[model samples]
Target: MNRRQFLCTTGAFAGWSGGVACQARAEAYTVDRALVLVDLNGGNDGLNTVIPIGDPLYRALRPTLAVPHDQVLPLDERTGLHPSLGPLLGAWRGQELAIVQGVGHDAGNRSHFRSRQIWDTASDTHEYRDDTWLAHASLPAASFVASCTDAARSIAQHEAAVVRIALHGFDTHENQALRHAALLGQLAQGLMMLRARLIASDDWHRTLVMTNSDFGRSARENAVGGTDHGAAAAHFLMGGNVRGGLWGAAPRLNALDTGDGLPVSLDFRQLHATACAHLGVAPPSSVERFAPLPLLRV
Candidate 1:
């Protein structure tokens, strides 16, 4: 109905419930599902990550940074994944990965602090809310934070109700080619390995692995072989129950906003709501107005 109420249902879906929601319902959903959040610490380059190989405009936009068309791991005739993320191909084939493209409030607010606040609260670009979504959800909003690169391994062992991981080194302000390649390789490997571990422990089916950054990098490469911060990013969702495949329209490179950034096709709240729906939480009327994304299996 209202912004805070929208976030209230959303926080539960985002895995910040902290058992507070469960206490009221008697601990039913506690052990069944857990959310694994992979926060690409800095803005990730979405254009390169989800390469638009068929779009001539993409190569024109980032000639130096574009992955050779021949090398792209083809998802469709028009779309492909960066070579560095080759490890994820198996999941793609198995239908365990869902790629949501053009996700963000808008191509505005390039400031990392501001963008993250907006995401954390599921606020639209035009609105800013002080309270966190978790507090509104009636959850204590607790966390079990570990900053190590190897924290994924540790996270598998503990299996908290929710785990938010920050993979550093995405802020590729200079020399983005080499830096982004290495980071993407690491990301792909980490995701594949995490899935393998979950499968071994019989937790893969219930664990949802989602990735997002503060925002997305510019659609065009800068003179320094890097990109400046922009708005809108493509995100990935992987899990046994995930309805794996591409979702939403690709970022419209030909049609750029005033910031020369891709316009937001699907609001970031839609992504949050998809995850919330996966956890069987009803969307508040506000998010429901955006409609449903069948991101999870029935």
Candidate 2:
């Protein structure tokens, strides 16, 4: 199927009905907070990003690819941040960052397109959805913006309640070290820049920043020194009001699934629900089964 046909068939058209309904209800609700979603398009190697320094199993599993204990910035005795994420240490030290471990759905699908669709629609592995959860909720005109590389620019130009930034190139199937480091560095630098701008404009307190991905990479490295698509990666939530600290326990490297992938400790929908609460709106009816996480202090 062509791209347009595929999108329409999968549920992209499902939003028109909800959008109309939401427009009618929008007059009754008001929210002052803003949410920024940073999507890492490729499956991120969570094991390398958030090093489990104290876990013996991690070092044993990927001796060559593991970030050495000394290289990581310790968040606690057990875990630490990757070296390339040094720019984010300030947020962590100020208690404005929360690391949520093992964020993914059950029965993970490794395909890039399918997994991303599931995340975008917040659907189960067996189900197909066309409309994104965001489209089901209405806001004021020009209150939401979605972009792949222009989120920062768009945020500066438009007064939106929600902004989505999608960053690609996390799929590191070969020579991962160099590619991953560059990507992480860019992410760190961009976030720091955005934070500084927001704080200077006195908008930081009202804004929330979070990161997600299609899935996590395998714990074990391949022959080429890169990880394959896996499941249950780590995610981050940061902002002035975030309840900074670790939200979920790190996955056990030794107790991997049959495919040598980390088991999910936190479902991603919880994060979405939290965003809905922050924006003063109810979550999409489809995700009522999942509760919002206590990640914000507001």
Candidate 3:
């Protein structure tokens, strides 16, 4: 499939039938809020992204890959953020950004394709889903928005309540520090630009932006100075209505699952339910097993 078709099938507009159908039905809707999802396609290294400085295990496990305590941007006494995420420090300080920790579903799958499919469909590891959870949930018309291209402009120009932007390149099997830093820089810069545009257009307060990934990297770096597939990464939710300030429990470095990955502390579905609640949509009964997380205002 072509890039646009691939995006429509897998990205934010996954559920909608077609653009023509969406535009035709657009007049029937009255949207008061909006949601922007940034999908980090490859598994992000959560341990490095959100450093656990207080945990000695972190330093020992990731000796070569660990970000030094002095270099990390302090979020609290125990935990800090990667140096590349310095751009978001203002958002954290202003309480507009929330860090949701230890997010993953049960039975973490390590393969990129399988794990991402599971995350996209919001299905249990043992169960297979033909349709994505986003498709099942009632959403506003889907508009194809690519992050690298004119994403901010699209959000400013269109009235679509749900906009998704898919970004890749987090795999990082080699030279992780350089590659991940560049990717994180792009993310931080893109979000900052989007925020500026929204504020300029008076849509900042009404828009919610969140980030998700396939899974997380292993707590321990591999022999190649990179990480393998793991589980339970950190996510971010930012908006004016969001009650931000570190929403979930930090992942314990010493308490790893059998796969030597962080244990799932907060189910990803809870975050989905929270997003549905924020958008005034009900999550499908098939996937409503978890309650909506109290991350945002009703």
Top TM-score hit: 3
Give the lDDT ranking, best first: 2, 3, 1
For model 1, residues 136-185, the per-residue Cα lDDT tens digits are 21122222122322334433443334456667777787899999998898
What is the TM-score ranking, best to worst?
A: 3, 2, 1
Q: What lDDT score is found at residue 181 in candidate 2? A: 85
RMSD of each: 5.6, 7.4, 5.8
**TM-score of candidate 2 to 2 decimals:** 0.84
Q: Which lDDT tens digits does candidate 3 get at residues 129-177?
A: 8777763112223222235234445445543556667667888777788
Q: What is the C-alpha lDDT of each candidate?
A: 0.72, 0.74, 0.74
Q: How far is candidate 2 from the true structure (C-alpha RMSD, Å)?
A: 7.4
Question: Clashing pairs in model 1?
Answer: none
TM-score of each: 0.82, 0.84, 0.87
How does model 2 fare in lDDT? 0.74
Error of 2 at 11 (Å): 16
